[model samples]
Target: MKRHDALIRVAEYDRFRRPTSIRIDVTAGCPIPVVRTIFGAPDKPTETVVNVSLVTESHPTLDPTRKYKDRCRLARRIADRLGIDEGCHVRVDAGPYATYYRVYEIREHDAPLVVHEEHLDRLGIDGEQTVRLSTTIPQETPEQVRERGGLAETLVDDQTCEGVLVTAPHGGAVERGTDAIASRTYDRLDDGGVRASLWLLQGYNPPEGSAVTAHRRWHVGGFDRAVDGYPGLATLTGRAFDLVVGVHRSGYEWIEVGGRIDASVRERVADELRTRAGREVRTDLDRLHLPGTNPRISTNFLSKGGDRGLHVECTPGTCDRHVEEAAAALAETIRRVLA
Candidate 1:
């Protein structure tokens, strides 16, 4: 099937449903731990508020506009339901078709800028302070990592990849295939700290003879080598780009950028070819050959035995507009070769 047709099918399958909410029962006094367990940790330490509550929204089908509103309403309802004498802590996260809510309480002493001379004197600290650290890892597949313990904050980029921020209780660790990819630690004086860790997987290569792989090859280059060797690019591809695009498009939610090819670029190339051919063009990048690193466009129009199939491949990160230009260039190359 063509890439456009495949995308349309994915959209159809994601049809939205009516909104619904779920209120989880949480312990009152242990708000920090409970909140962390449910929604990871707060962006800041003093930000931890105890009177928090959590709610989830669901629907029968897609309702893009009302989804965020529904999530807000559910959060307010959870706050009202808690009905604590003190102010309630609330945070809401809503997506194209899903939403999550969290509420908690705040302790006065936890607030910063408040003088705690006695506490500081005992700890031998000079003044108010905070600590922050970040790190990431590599994985074979995103499914290899487990997400049961904490909520994940996802960052979406132009490509389909996502960067996820996960927080858990201090001293706890995130499990990734029997290995601890990240661990949360805290000191006696510290409120709590998040052990920032990341898991990256190499760019995806479709299994041989698989329909999905075949489809991807037709639209984009078959192998994604941009992220294969480099650690930074691999992390971005797996943790961010792969998650956003692959999850929504493939019906699988995980972060993995299998190759260096930019998806948007491939789509644009396919679109241009379809337009120029004045009919649907079948792309077959799988058989095309190029150097491991920098590749120059080349072609073989006639085989020793018979006419060889026309092939087109692209550089990593090529956008759709560029892909279109490249495809046109390839067509010209073919014309010259045949002549």
Candidate 2:
């Protein structure tokens, strides 16, 4: 469809719905390509302020009503590329996946222009705190909370061919849909003529055989061994995979591809994904290296054997809506890179 045909109308656009802001990549190529591959010439990531608490540097002086409308217009264009109905509620999904993400909540204090989640955790402003600042964090008793770390369970599908490892520490109940995303990715990697190990934290009840019996949160708790001394997540680093891939869920429509991938194959991978996922492809810039997967972070995926792993964050919507297509594309991209 033409650009003029894709205008967003909001009968009631709720911003505080999540309080978290997101960015959508609007380049070219819909249902078959929305930034993933459709309808434009622009190759830059567009900002969409979701949770209304957003405070940005650019357009800082703009009135609230005008800003909302402008964001809605940008969001509408993005959704249209994905075949989303006009006037429907939508949010940007790829921005949070960018290799670099501009964190706004830290603005409340004297913080850097851009920050990683790990940095916030170090400041004692953890994932829970971020949720409280943006979206809601459900309250549960310590007895019920998993991070206490008594159990341990990790699954490994090691083929030992390419020395690549695909991991999802937050899989299953830990992070909701992450396990499924990683599962598809694991199989995809295998199908691409390359072999690798896939590790998952499926915290068991009795710590069967070697799996951990505790149900602690992976990201936060995993850091103790890497940074502090927590034993729950200490073992993953020992695997020593050359290229570790830690996948997570995002809040935008496109897959936020990050990491300093070899310049030779970056565009090829992006193009493959654009055509497969039917969403726009965007590289990280505003947030170039997030602590979650950056090698600088002790517990990150990139710190593995080759220190070459990349952190891929996909929006909840895109992950669900384009899982099959995305898996095939991702596998193909890896195959191309290996070739």
Candidate 3:
């Protein structure tokens, strides 16, 4: 058929009876080719690469309408290449004209018409990708890990390890602890060739000691563990703080203690930690209030916000030992919060 004549017929067919979505891929010889003709046309075809599957569909013609002129143009070119004839039937099948097409490829040259089909086959185009990570937590009460990100299923039979998955915001590794809600960092490799680490924490509170020292150790330990498991992991970070101390107004235990620290100091601390850990840390100090009764430290670490910090109530009139222990834990919580 004459190219121009073929093009005109294709255009008319498109206007009157175009299917919603048609999938195509260019022949490998023409990695980036233009649609020359539905059957044949003189107009320059729209340019597109043949690396991936292409879906062409008609746009709505209703009021405030969108016209798929480009798509139609491409479709016409494909139809011409396929040698679609007048009797060919095209119909919509799924989701209101989502997945439907009818057109047979007519051989042009006996040299075996070549077109890339792998792109469409690999897409699993019929449905969406299913989330593979597990959401359940087996080590602690599920309630403890609720609302934590990166809470996927455990890969190992033993309860100590949890499988973690990470995705970079912009195709690179994210700072530790910013991606998941675990107590320590766990390294994860994604299918897209990106590396990330998941930090998971098991305890609700930090162990007692020098608050700063204990938390630093915890952070280092978590990172070390992640590195050991995933040698490719460049860094590891994440935080896990007791909600009781972090989210005030939850009617949780916290003590209010008039202290020297100011909001600026807290913010500065938080900033420093973010810089050091390469991740965003969070804490809740406003909600740290005594649960049952007021204590010596009516509210310790009250009005707190730091690079990484958590505020929680301490029992009033508690013995020095208890206060020291609580203070240590609170301090570590701050470190993790900042981490």
Best by TM-score: 2
Off by over 4 Å in 3: 1-124, 127-182, 185-268, 274-339
Over 73-188, each residue of candidate 2 has an lDDT whose tens digit, in order, gives: 22233232322232222221121110111122212243112223233211222232211121111112223234422212233332223466666655544454655666677677
Give the distance in Å from residue 34's predicted Cα in candidate 2 to where it truly belongs: 45
TM-scores vs. true structure, each candidate: 0.18, 0.45, 0.17
Of 2 and 3, the candidate ranking higher by TM-score: 2
Ranking by TM-score: 2, 1, 3
- Of models 1 and 2, which has the larger TM-score? 2
The candidate 3 region of ten consecutive residues with least summed lDDT is 2-11
Q: In candidate 1, which residue ranges exceed 4 Å CA deviation?
A: 1-46, 53-70, 73-99, 102-149, 152-247, 250-264, 268-339
Task: Estimate, for each residue in 141-199, the C-alpha lDDT of model 1 and write its tens digit.
Answer: 22321221112211111222232221111111111111111111111001222112222
Report RMSD (Å) for each prediction in the order shown: 24.1, 21.3, 26.9
lDDT of 3 by residue, 1-339 (tens): 211111110112232222212122243453222232122222433211112124422223211131111111123443353333322322111211111112223333321111123211111234322211110111222233233211111111111112222211111011222222221121112222222222222212112212122111111111221221211121212221111122111112323321223455345434543443333333334532322112211122111221222222222222112333332333343434434
